[model samples]
Target: MTSSSRRVVVAINPAASFGLGSEVGPALVTTLRGLGHEVTSLTEPDFAQLLDATRAALREKPDALVVGGGDGMVNLGVTALEGTRIPLGIVPSGTGNDMARGLSIPIGDTEAAITALTAALHRPPRVIDAGRIAFDGGRARFACILAAGFDALVNERANRMRWPRGRSRYTIALLIELARLRPIEYRLTLDGVEHVERALLVAVANNLSFGGGMKVAPDASLDDGLFDVVLVRPLGRLAFLRIYPRVFAGTHVTDSRVVVHRAREVRIEAAGVVAYADGERIAPLPVDIHMQEGSLRVLA
Candidate 1:
């Protein structure tokens, strides 16, 4: 869709990023309208409500769909728009705008993002890869990243916190969970190779980062047609403390305790495990993850 002819529908999550959604809604709509695009703003009622609103918005057959919230909101919109021709534009307003940061989108700066969106609308769409998680006849959607074990626990805790927005909340949650966390035994099959280990976390990436700025899979690429599987193997509490800082700098990949592999598909199995995609729980272990090539045409 081109700039002059495109129609836009902006979906707002009024409770995202610790309630910053209410503040960003008006600013984004005003900017898009000022740019002369036909704009409609829809408030997301809840996770379930988002899917229907997204389908309804897509039925309008707009040139582009704009998501005005954080990663979870983006995930909901993407799930609704997957396998369709419409491209997605994101205005990051979540606690951890991981996907937006990975795509180099300007988060929290509505004016700059709107200007960028205007420019992006005129350019050819960029085809990016997205990942899928499947288990027990059920599947959930995500585009950025998926993780299990310690990282998933951290996400669960962060979701429940009532204060301390953004990265600080995540940091506090991680620290709080550190005391009682235990490594779980698991088996990972990547491509065709099989391995078993006690692990702290297993992260599969379609993009580079998660938890705000931590480069859990630093070498991951959105269009590479491959996913980076990173496993943080069992480590003592002191060792975990020593290596945790390196994750933010993305230098932890070189450590022996951390194993990184590239594969087109992977399967993970563990007992009583927690799993998360983007930031939402999809299933337990024994899950299959694979990349969908050229599945999304995103406004970068």
Candidate 2:
């Protein structure tokens, strides 16, 4: 869409990135408006309210929906605009802007991200695959990783923390969760084939990175129409710690305990495990996750 004809809605979660949204959200509005595009800026008290407001904004059939938060916010946009004509854009204003990292959007640099978004607006939206998780009564859309086991627990713990704000809080929470790490028994069905394994974590990745550039599925692709099923088998605490750092570089996939499978659908069954997608709680285990190619149109 061209600048003059573009009707853009920029939704900001004020609490995201430890309150970075309060500034970045308005800047995005100014930048888009200054470019002569019609822009609507929105901010809400929390994610649920933001989701509702974003859905309302989508009803207007805006040319694009720009989100000013991390992957969780992008996931919210995926929910609101996936399979619709509206293309989603990212501002990467969150603690773990993993979705931006996966999309190669500038992270922690607001100006660069804005510049990228503006440039992308002048071109066609990039079509990419999206993940869906269906449970007993509901389903959710994710643009990045869907994780269960240890890391999901870390996400759970971090969500409950109110002190020591910002990334350090997640560091503290991660160390705490790591101390309690143990093998989890999971029954996984990949593309209809069943397997039972005791693992520390399993990630169904639609993109290459999550957890702030951790290459959980380093070889994964958004247009491949498949999920990279990453499984980390049980390992000793020290060994797991040794491999943990390798995940940042994506070399951990070479470990003997690490197994990568490519599939179009996955069914996960594990006791007492909660699933987290795009760093937000999705639901409990026993969920069916599948991939849909070209399900999302993204601006860069």
TM, every model: 0.91, 0.94
The residue ranges of model 1 lying beyond 4 angstroms of the native Cα positions read: 1-3, 16-19, 157-173
Error of 2 at 87 (Å): 0.7
How much lDDT does candidate 2 score? 0.89
Taking the tens digit of each residue's C-alpha lDDT, what string does model 2 give over 59-168?
Answer: 88888999988777888899988668788999988878888887889988899999999999879999999988999789998989999989998878888899887788
Measured by TM-score, how close is model 2 to the native structure?
0.94
Looking at candidate 1, the ten consecutive residues that score lowest on lDDT are: 14-23
- lDDT string for model 1 (103-174, tens) is 898977867776777788878878898987889978877888889889888878888898997678988998
Q: Give candidate 2 regions above 4 Å deviation.
A: 1-3, 16-19, 161-166
Cα-based RMSD of the predictions, in order? 2.6, 1.9
lDDT of 2 at 144: 92
